[model samples]
Target chain A: MQHFLRKTVAVFESLGDRSLDSFERLGRSTLFLVRVFKSIPFVFLRPWLLIQQLYSVGVLTIVIVLVAGTFVGMVLGLQGYNILVRFNSESSLGTMVGLTLVRELGPVVTALLFAGRAGSALTAELGLMKTTEQFSALEMMAVDPFKRVIAPRFLAGFLSMPMLAAIFSAVGIYGGYYVGVYLLGVDDGAYWAQMQKSVDFHEDFMNGVWKTVVFGFVATWIALFEGYDSVPTSEGIGRATTQSVVNASLAVLGLNFILTALMLETS
Target chain B: MTRQILEIWVGVFVAAGIAALFMLAMKVSNLSTVSTGDTYEITARFDNIGGLSIRSPVKASGVLVGRVSNIKYDKDYSVAVVTMSIQNRFDSFSIDSRASIYTAGLLGEQYIELVPGIEDNYLEDGSDVVMADSALILENLIGRFISEIISK
Candidate 1:
């Protein structure tokens, strides 16, 4: 009876501890976010750091975005053609491909890819720095590590996302055109005409840009936060890197849906 | 040397992004409309607009001439009022020119198709296009098909 009572107390205590731990994590994350935002001015002041970060994060990620984008567009062309053929409206293929890529798939897919590619790298790099006491070394040298280390990468990731998304969407449209027009033989004129008639610059394109910007900020924030707070060990670095990718990807997708709904509903 | 190379590549990347955006705006979203010289406004009333909304392209002979600027309900006339902006270059449309709402495909966006008339006199700004055909609603057609089958 005494043993049973002790087990019950232990379970309750663990639950309390879990809640407290999560609350503490939330508080820490908020503080980290503020610190990161405060470090933004340093990104402008130290342009070379931003450029280096951009090269590592942005330039390196371009090929993947392009390859992924092209394939996605081709698939959209094939599927949209098949469905539209049933309705005897295959000529609207361009509208389907353009709207899908520009409004929804482009930003969302690029962000997920960005999260997987850059977010994980940032987390791992920072975690490794932590493990090797590099951040501490900077502190000892009277350097603000947040401005020196974190700000440039954050700015690069934030800036790179929208540009990558734009490229993806553009390449995707071409892929769609090749498949829909050349492979499937949909009327080329009607395809473009339909798209031009339907798509609006202010409504679809700008909304997509807004979404990617927000996603970029969120993704970079999660990556940097996870890195900054990771335990100073090899296993901890690996875990934080995985967590950063997973968390950023999920946040991006959730925000995409909310933003899409708000954008579509409003205008 | 490495810095210069990297800067060049970065500049190329930024240029490509901007170029892609320009294509999106100009070719895809019709941003060239702003450069389309001055336009004259005209109004048309329709019995039913169906899915026609503001900014729907106004086409002449399958060529884009202008766009629908606004849509409002004409309560007194029991119809929908559609305001259109026809470009100055294409201002030769006669007063008797017919305006019809047309759908490109079986399932596609609706647009305004203007058919030029024989009248040599041209339509002026703020003039009402009296002859107009409303859009054919799909649901109504489907209903008619069902009712015809029932009667048969």
Candidate 2:
């Protein structure tokens, strides 16, 4: 009885501690976000740094975006074609493929991929910099690390997500087109026309764009924050990088659900 | 230099993103298909709208001439008041024209079909269409058939 009571007490104690830690981290993250935003003006001042970050963060991620987008789109086309043919409504294959990609999969898959690839990289890079006291060195030289290291990377990531999602959607549509038109022998004109007829620019496309923008901001912030808050050790760096990717992915999916619900309700 | 090459690549990537957005807008979305020219509004009341919704195409003689812009329940008439915007170029609707709800294909979306009449007068902006027919409900037809058989 004593041991059981003690164990229950210990569990409650740990739970309380965890909640407290989470609250502290949330407060720190808010402050960090403010600092990052405040330093955004610095990004334009040194345009070259922003470009470099953009290259590393955005350009480097293109290959995965393209490959994943194509495969997703092709699969959608194949599945959509099979499903839509049931009611002799195979002509709606384009609408299904286009809407599914533009409204949901494009931003979602790109964010997940970005979290795995660029998010992890950002965490690791910042973690290593912290591990080597590079941030302190910058401070010693009167350089604000937020401006020099964090904001440009944040801005680049934030900018890249929407663009990458757009590319993903575009490639995905083409992939669907290839499968539906060439492989499945669907009428090309009907496929394109049906998609255009169904998909509203403001409702579907712009909503997706906005979703990516929010996702980009979230993903990059989590990655950068994990690195900034990392304990100064190799194990800590590894842990932070892992946490960054996992947390960013979970945050993105949760935010997508909320955003989708709101968008659907309004539309 | 490698730096210049990187800059060029970044520029290309940005441009590609823009192009992709443009392609999506043009080929995948209804941005281009939506009429931007002058339009005239027509209102009609129906007893039942069925599955009629906003932005549903309004057709004339099997050709699209307008779109249903809004749908609201009228408390006074206890009916669905539907507002449609027709393109100015196709401004040939007579005052005695009939507006009926139609379904596209089988089990597809509903639209409003405008049948022209031989009246000399034309329907102007904010014209209230008096000759409006409500949508056909399949369940009602089956119910009526059952009732007639029971009575017989």
Candidate 3:
């Protein structure tokens, strides 16, 4: 028993040492990222990063947004209508659609879709670059890898998230309208009119937009951090990609709670 | 490259369509009469304007015709003063147009509802709607009812 205890202690100490080393490396890369952000004015020197981010966030993810938004809206409308039908208060569909889409579904669904698609891709690309020593090569040439690779992606993810959230909100509301009005046979005028009346500028739309910004930062930062720290091996690259998706998704959810709490407190 | 270009065009179209739909829906709803030269202003005072927001609809007989334009606190009256823009078609609103803050449903939004009265004097733009009602918040009403029942 004593021998087992000793072995366990030794294992724990080695694990702790490894974790400390990883954190130290993370600290350095984060500082490097900060420096790259400071030099964003020089982004005119490399427009490809912006284009790449735009393409990745906007153009590539349209189908996912469309499908997800439509399905989610349909489900919400169906479920909400089921519950509301008990009271014979079907006209509250507008408030229901507006509230659900703006407060919860808009930001959360978009972030999840982004994580599955662009977030994974970003991690793998960065991980491969790290594993191939391409990052080191760029450094050797006095080219800042953070500026060339990390910053552009970070900016792209950040900018793309809000735009995606907007699209998600718009599409989701329309989806709800279609399902509620046409399919479910609810009054079209009341469904839309109620939404217009119920949805306030400050409470609904602004809160949704605010949450997306946080989601963007969390997704980009976690994905980039994971990729930047990948070990120089195929296995390491694979591990980093997996970690990126998991970490980015978790971070998106975690930050969403924090933002919701903060918004509630302030409001 | 061709695929990318096509994809970009599709995205733009999708985005534009969504935006246009929202605008069209808002236009068709006609909640506010700001566009049709049918807007008239009226003021209401409330003791508390809980969750009352600018641009919230003003409804009469469940038909929307205007919106809350501004809100302010009256120091002398110790009340919240809400200014609303009603349609000029509702121009024959009497001096007794009663404004009440009511919820759409349980756990839903709040809007100012106007119950038009049959008094002689007509309410003009910038005139005060004499009778005003505040929201009977659910918690407060329930609490009062429960207390009364318990006491009884």
TM-score, one value per model:
0.83, 0.96, 0.73
**How accurate locally is residue A158 in candidate 2, as Cα lDDT from 0 to 100?**
98
Shift in Å, residue A231, candidate 1: 2.0
- Per-residue CA lDDT of candidate 3, range A1-267, in tens? 999999999999999999999799779767866876776655657876667566765668767887888888888788888888898877778668777887788899899888878888888888888888889899999987777777778887887787777677777777888888888888988887667655655666668778888888888777777777777688988898898888888888888898889887766
Pick by lDDT: 1 or 2, better one: 2
- The iRMS of the candidates, in order, is 1.2, 0.6, 4.9
Chain A TM-scores, candidates in order: 0.95, 0.99, 0.91
User: Which tens-of-lDDT digit does each residue in B1-152 have in candidate 2?
Assistant: 49999999899889988899899988899999877899999999999999998888999998889999999999997999999999999898999999999888768899999998999899999999989999988788799999999999
Fnat scores for every prediction? 0.46, 0.85, 0.02
Please compute the TM-score of chain B alone for each predicted structure, in the order given. 0.85, 0.91, 0.76
The window of 10 residues in a row where model 2 chain A has the poorest summed lDDT is: A84-93
Error of 2 at B102 (Å): 0.5
Q: Candidate 3: which stretches are off by over 4 Å?
A: A1-26, B2-152
DockQ top scorer: 2
Q: What docking grade does candidate 1 earn?
A: medium
Q: How well is each residue in A1-267 modelled by candidate 2, as lDDT tens digits?
A: 999999999999999999999999999999999999999998898999999998999999999999999999999999999998897888899999999999999999999999999999999999999999999999999999999999999999999999999999999999999999999988999999999999999999999899999999999999999999999799999999999999999999999999999999887
